[model samples]
Target: MDGQDEVSAREQHFHSQVRETTICFLLFAVLYVASYFIITRYKRKSDEHEDEDAVVNRISLFLSTFTLAVSAGAVLLLPLSIVSNEVLLSFPQSYYIQWLNGSLIHGLWNLASLFSNLCLFVLMPFAFFFLESEGFAGLKKILEDLDEQMYMITLEEEALQRRLNGLSPSVECDLLDLEQELQNVKTLKAKLERRRKASAWERNLVYPAVMVLLLFETAMSVLLVACNVLCLLVDETAMPQGSRGPGIGHASLSAFGFVGAALEIILIFYLMVSSVVGFYSLRFFGDFIPKKDDTTMTKIIGNCVSILVLSSALPVMSRTLGITRFDLLGDFGRFNWLGNFYIVLSYNLLFAIVTTLCLVRKFTSAVREELLKALGLRKLRLSSAPREPDSAKPSANGHQKAL
Candidate 1:
């Protein structure tokens, strides 16, 4: 009787997972397609000028597609694997068949996981490159050069002043040339000041975007873990009775869940700190009202916070609903909807973060060039007239006084 009940439960559990997976995949596919279309259209519009950043954007799109393809493949294969076990019992014996039947599903899952992990690694360095390439680093270099130029000019002025000491008043041309150079230096100094201000503005936007992307990646990691946990739980319940140790099954699931929860806690802290820092830094350095399309950083941070809140709420719901309990002999089931909820929330956060960083970095680079021009540092030239020889000979008394 118990065995019969267990079989019935397992069948039901399998069907439920199939349904949930189907729904989730459909939703993921829709979003993925929509995002692709939007990005493609944007690229087409921007491609006329052949902007240098176009290549970076394309790279991001490629990575996004790779991530989606691998993830979708894994999701699709999971249900097929389950169905195959029930439906295909007597295939011809072959090594390939055994490998496909036994190991392919696991391989697909690992492949999907690898793609998702690669997204993070790819995005971080990409963001850094975008920030640097957008002229943020160049601006800093220019400022340093300006400061050094100003110092050199000041040293020249001091030397010129000393040279003028005890000289007759006849060297008017030399004095005039020195004065002109001083005026030119002053003009250049003003220009450098303007460039510095512009650079600060650009940094304000790009830095926040980068920080938001990092938070988004962290949230995605949390979501991937949650999804894996859900899949694992379903697999466990669908397994035939006596196939695995009861204690080991429970211990493993619980450990995975605990680790995920711990990660959630750490991510929440990260989101909070990053958001606060980014928000204030932007306000301090840039315009408070970000341009419509340039508001990606704010949006990404907002998504991260929302996910953090949702993930934190799940443990409470799990404890309250008593959904954590599962019979080892019975089919897999999720009375705990918390895991699925967290997964969706985490994915959204990740998407928002990556998109925002990419956009902001590009926009800030454009703004930096404008600022440099406004500061008059764009191709400034300095020249001084030839110095005239001193006409008056120094008297013996004047020479003694100089000594």
Candidate 2:
């Protein structure tokens, strides 16, 4: 009777846990939907016409930016959901322990798991189907607008400065208004210049090397997600239970899931910092409009597609996937560190090869352009040179005009 009672209690406890997890999932799902709406409703158009002098408006804008950044950072939880009990973060001694101990990630794991599953099973394939929407049009428009406004502002500043200069030294009354105008013009010009710098590919965020790192980081995250998903999707009979370390519960994974999750959360924080510091960084995917015109955005979409291919698991699950289990719905025990390590190594190699190819492609194009420019310049110099008549051609060292 005691044994039966204990089993019944365990089952009840399990149901309770599931109940709470379901509630959290529903709550987060609602918030997730709301977040999109909130981001979309922000005052993007206000950027065009807001008075720079309005302290209140500026404060409101800052708050809005902060919210967007928070959402962007929240996306890091995606890895935690994907890596699950397998990663080091799930290690009891790991620092991420607090996450499951009444932390946000612990409370919201179900939602995150669902999100990660969708990203792996649904979005990855969709990205291949829609690799790109549009690109560079929005960027060109912003650059051209900045250039035009800057030129106008420069002319305005000069005109105002000239007006102030024309006034008599004793005419303090007229100088006051002109001085303020000039100051405002200068301020506006400075703002435009800053925007241009942020948008430039050569600037810090979008630099080629930085881009490669970002791509690799994202690739690793996707790989981890795939690993977790595979544990559920693959045939359970093959590996069987107890073939690895003692299985850990997902709830206990509050600490650290893996190295990748830890890195992702850190990256998310860094992303927030970068966004807040006046770089025209990526929005939290607030809108799709930029996909048509922004090269940076286009690259982001491309990165997703590339990562999906790198993280594919067809070799193991190709035949057994459907026959074995429905993914995102099985018991994938933790403690498979060796398998995880091997998988990580394999992904690293693949990512490295792809990165090298991309870098080489970039280098070759740059070198080709340089060579073309050099050849063109040489041709221009030669074609423009005067050809002396054959009879009057001078020797290399000594030549006088043969009149």
Give lDDT per model, in order. 0.45, 0.43
Which regions of candidate 1 are displaced past 4 Å? 1-44, 90-100, 123-132, 135-403
Residue-level lDDT of model 2, residues 115-141, one tens digit each, is 444554665445433422212323554
Task: List the candidates' TM-scores in order.
Answer: 0.27, 0.33
| Superposition error at 1 for model 2 (Å) | 4.6
Q: Ten residues in a row with the worst lDDT in model 2?
A: 318-327
* Tens digits of per-residue lDDT for model 1, 85-158: 32233343444444333333333334444544454456434643563465543455457668999999999988
Q: State candidate 1's TM-score.
A: 0.27
Off by over 4 Å in 2: 1-15, 22-38, 41-78, 82-183, 190-209, 212-359, 363-403
Could you tell me how far off, in angstroms, the CA of residue 385 lies in candidate 1 after the best superposition? 99
